[model samples]
Target chain A: MATVASNQRGTGSRLKTWWTILKISLEERFVYRGDFALGTLMRFLPIITQVFLWYAIFAASGKEKIEAYTANGVVAYYMLTMISRAFSSMPGLCSGIALQVRDGEIKKYLIQPIDLLGFLLLTRIAHKLCYYVIALIPFTFVFFLCRGFFENGWPEASVLCAYFLSLIMGFLLGFFMEASLGLVSFWFLEVTSLAFVYNLLNFFLSGHMFPLDLLPDWAAQFINLLPFQYLAYYPAAIFQGTIEPNQVWQGMALEACWLMAFIMIARIMLNRGIHRYSGFGG
Target chain B: MTGYRPSYLNVFLTFARNSLVRDMSFRANFILQCISTISWTVMNIGFYLIVFQYTDSIGKETGWGRNEFFVFLATTWIINSLVQTFFMPNAQQFSELIRSGNLDFALLKPIDTQFVISFPRVDWAALSNLFVGFTLLCYSLYQLTTKAENPLIIDWRSILMYPFYIGCGTVIMYSVMITLAATSVWLGRNQTLYNFWFYITNFSRYPMEIYKVGWGMALWVFFTFIIPVLLVVNIPARIMARPLNTMNSQMWQLAGFAILATVACLMISRRIFVRALKSYRSASS
Candidate 1:
């Protein structure tokens, strides 16, 4: 009975620690309200180019649909991609981790009782929450302006739930994937080039540039086999109702699997990296 | 007062040599960056190849057929490579200079501050894009010439005008970038400089003809008449690839406008830079 009481107390203190981290992170993000608002608005500006570019392509093709996507549908796909990317895109996470490792700042994680991954995860959650609070207005305005593109309107509640789930999983997957890459700085001191290469690959393979279905059947199949699609394409596709309700569940399951795999990989890398690390100089 | 003048050409050459040495110091990193850039270019080409499978041209009656569009793409790379190599690194560092209080040293320099700020770092890796652009341009031009369908006639005039307009494009872009960098002095830390640059330049990457309809027309007019980024790549690429007879008188007028705009932009940007310098408060203060 006494051991059980002690375990409960330990869990309570750990939760308190995470709460503090989240609060601090939220405060940090909120401090740059104007920059955040401007940055968020600037991100949507590229969609204008996308709209025109796709309109031209569709007009030139003289097709009602290209690869099962109408002109509106294609534009909608890109807009949805912006949503998924907002959740999944951890802009500086990789570089931040690499800098920490290189500067021996990871020493704090070792000395402290808090788990590094948990602390980072909570911080990212705070970041996303703060981002949504600032970006909600711009997002609503843009979506309203582009409502015509979303001809399908909204999916049923079940699919919407799955879509939200996939986005959450994508967030976890992105964090873990980038964390793993950054932890490679333990073995390879400079990861800037590697990070660049990863970003380039992610931009393409994740179907951010164009839909994966636009590729040849074999190429599409091959890319679909990879986990990068779950980061951006899968969630967007789920929202678009391109994946059937049954397939949506399957895709979510696959995303969850990928997220679990990445989490494991990140954990292993962190353990090994800490083993290799030496905290020298104050 | 003793009359003393520094040779601008000599100063530029020294800067270039120093940058080359610095780039060479990290040979592996430099080579990796070059390879990465080339790989991205290759992927972009691959993307367009897939797009062309669905359509014969980029737009209805726009005349940006596959070969013609490829020429335009190559021109973009060439212009972008020149800007990135000569100016982008320095422009990116402008805010850092302010933040670190290093602008005072730049102010102390005897050379023109803008020239010094713009030319101190040349990214040698970016020249690889120039190489790839030229190769693609040559290949696409050959394909257009050899094609049985209304082959492109490239004459001495085009050969002369293409490089001239490319230089004009580079200058216009440099002016825009330097003006943006100058904002760093007032903003204190213009972290959004690159994002803003990318947003503006994104308009220039595509064929300007695409923007001639509906709401896009407003953007077209704004970019073409006000900022004139639309004229940067469009005029040079059109001169090189688009048949002369098919070109409207408006395009030729726009070509003339591009040259004038380049000079105007440079003078205006220099004025802005000087004004921004006056507003600069050193970090020490």
Candidate 2:
């Protein structure tokens, strides 16, 4: 029997692997610099229309408020949404693996004695983190433009620090959820369509384009019941200082529970997935 | 650019028919995709309308009403969709073909390779997106423009300019895509760049004026001369209505710009595509 490295799941080892994966992914992305930059530039288009619509809404309203939000608040909230996405966790990498495996390439991965999930999570997270780091330039530029319209909003250091921690936890939960979706590809060959539905559901629930608070009361409550809020709104609300600090622990507790649950699901899936593992060996 | 004589219309028919037949082979997938696209389009448009319904007018401009904005958004998007259907996919696929040493097979085929490669695939489902876009445009136009409501006839100039602008728009889009895909020759593959292109399809939905003056001018120049996205919808509509004096001159300059860009880029990209094909040393023995 081979040595299976029982203690390899320690945080330090995982961190080192994550760092290496990030470096490798960053190198891969560096080759497509122009495309990445252009994509960053292209992303501004929808926001442009959004800003225009807000300008119109302001014009139409004759200085009115919808619920608790003023026109400026709505714009700020959306801008915050964009910023949140730049930092939000990525979708699962299993979608790519699903395709890679179907093409019979996953066999190469099986020979490695190291933890596969660690490598998968590390590399995918690295690419997104780096992509967002590059993406931050534009996100900050827009935020600066947007900040001019808002009231004073640089939060206190302690609250801000708490928000930052919550943000990281939020990202981890979101990553775990999406990565689990990718892991599902071990069984399903065409997860693309499923991914579409998954992302669309997330787009609405995660409060990406609109604040969940803006949804009808019932809809808002329904979405809150799901885990998507921890993906975006929890962190965004903290940054906006709209959410209270006492609530932070509640949110974090929920995030921890879901993270634990999803990690178990992933472990189960990985184990079961190996039994039916064809490794493109059909 | 020497070539054996080939019937232009026949080439198109063959390509069109082949794509149609191939797509028909997976009839249910095509229908499902159509339904998916329709729902997706409605969701997007609904999101805009929700925002619009809550607002008085965009830009705080007196004349730029909500319906007009929707009309503007929808019309341009439809034309953009048509261009996407025609050009964007092929450009993306062509880049892939080059990367895989697959372009060599196309060059071997007894046809004008460009004609064959450009229209060899079809997604008729996108046609539903076009219909939705057109219907939304018409509905919004009726709400905004009194002339349309009164059944007053369109001026010859406006009618003529509509198709003319579409032609210019196609040329502009084709030029941008052709060049972007042409990067495949140097970059090994540009599928990542392809991701950038589709995401920007939302840009032309708003009038260029919403951007501050300097940026607006920059957009006019870039979209007009380079990407030529404006000719797809905005500038043409601007010409039709004589919305702004500056816009009228822009439409003409844009058309001329598109023609020049198309000829120049097509020559360069084709040569590069050919060169890349020659560069390929297959991994297989």
Q: In order, how many clashes per candidate?
A: 0, 8
- Clashing residue pairs, backbone N/CA/C < 3 A, model 2: A56-B57, A56-B58, A57-B55, A60-B56, A60-B57, A92-A178, A94-A182, B223-B228
> How many clashes does the backbone of model 2 have?
8
What C-alpha lDDT, on a 0 to 100 scale, does residue B4 get in candidate 2? 71
Give candidate 1's fnat, 2 decimals.
0.69
**Interface root-mean-square deviation for each candidate?**
0.8, 2.9
Q: A1-282 in candidate 1: lDDT tens per residue?
A: 998998899898988888999999999999989878878888988888888888899999999999879999999999999888998999888899999999989999999887888888899999999999999988998899889999999988998899998998888899999989988999988999999999999999999989888999999988887889988999999889888887777777777788889999999999998999998998
Q: Write the per-residue lDDT of candidate 2 for residues B139-254, one digit (tens) a residue.
A: 76565556544332346766676667666666656655665676676777776766556554455666665543444567556665556555466655555433433344645675
lDDT of 2 by residue, A129-214 (tens): 67777777776776777686565478789778977787777766766777677777778767777677677777767888576776
What local lDDT score does residue B1 receive in model 1, on the 0 to 100 scale? Answer: 21
- Candidate that would win on lDDT: 1
Instruction: Report the poorest 10 consecutive residues by lDDT, candidate 2 chain A.
Output: A1-10
Give me the overall lDDT of model 1.
0.91
Instruction: Give the Cα error of residue A42 in candidate 1, in Å.
Output: 1.1
